[model samples]
Target: MVEVEAAGLIAIGAGIAVGLTGLGAGIGEQSIGAAAIGAMAEDPKFFGKGLLMTVIPESIVIFGLVVALILLFVF
Candidate 1:
């Protein structure tokens, strides 16, 4: 019974960690996306930089997923 409860708690924690990180990534990407669009509108040359900036925020979600996977499988 205690083991089950502990497992449930761990699952909950993993969910929260992934959820929060996803939320953060979304928020970060939103701003970057907006800026990228605006910059692209002004000058096409900015596309590369804007794309790079936009993708950087995506790493946050990847890291979050890794953390969740580790939590679920390791602990």
Candidate 2:
């Protein structure tokens, strides 16, 4: 019973880690994407920089996944 409880808690922690990160990244990406589109509209040359900037926030999601994996398997 104790082990089951521990496992459940661990799963919850992992889920929170991933869920929050994804939500944050999505929120961040929305603003960035809008700005990128705006900049690209003004000058086509800004597309590359805008795309790079927009993608940076997505790395947060990967970090979150890594944390969740570590929690689930290592903790």
Candidate 3:
């Protein structure tokens, strides 16, 4: 019973962490993506930098996913 409760707590916490971080990352990436596309439309040469900047938010979600997975399995 205690183990189950602890696991539940860990799951909840991990979920919350992932949810918040992912939400922020999604929002951030969307903004960057929009800007990147707009910039690219103006000048094709800006593609590299714009794309790089847009994908920068991926790290946040990746890190959050790592933490969430670790919590789910390790706990």
Candidate 4:
């Protein structure tokens, strides 16, 4: 019974970690995406830089997913 409860808590924690990270990534990406679009509108040459900047925030979600998976499987 205790093990079950502990597993449930761990699951909850994992969910929270992933959810909060995803939210943060979304917020970060939103600002970057807006800037990217604005910069692209002004100069087409900024496309590569803007795309790189926009994609950088996605790493946060990837890290979060890895952590969640580790927590679920290892703990």
Best by TM-score: 4
Model 2: which ten-residue window has the lowest total lDDT?
A: 55-64
Clashing residue pairs in candidate 1, if any? Answer: none
- For model 3, give the 10-residue run with minimal summed lDDT: 57-66
The TM-score obtained by model 2 is: 0.91
What is the full ranking by lDDT, best candidate first? 4, 2, 1, 3
Q: Clash totals for all models, in order?
A: 0, 0, 0, 0
Candidate with best lDDT:
4
lDDT of candidate 1 over 1-74, digit per residue (tens) = 99999999989988988899889999999999999999999999999999999988888888988998999999
- lDDT tens readout by residue for model 4, 1-75: 999999999999899889999999999999999999999999999999999999898899899989999999997
lDDT of 4 at 28: 97
Which candidate do you rate higher for TM-score, 2 or 3?
Answer: 2
Model 4 stretches astray by more than 4 angstroms = none
Superposed Cα RMSD, model 4: 1.0
Clash pairs, candidate 2, are none
Top-down TM-score ranking: 4, 2, 1, 3
lDDT score of residue 9 within candidate 3: 94
- lDDT for each candidate structure: 0.92, 0.94, 0.90, 0.94
Ranked by lDDT, the better of candidates 1 and 4 is 4
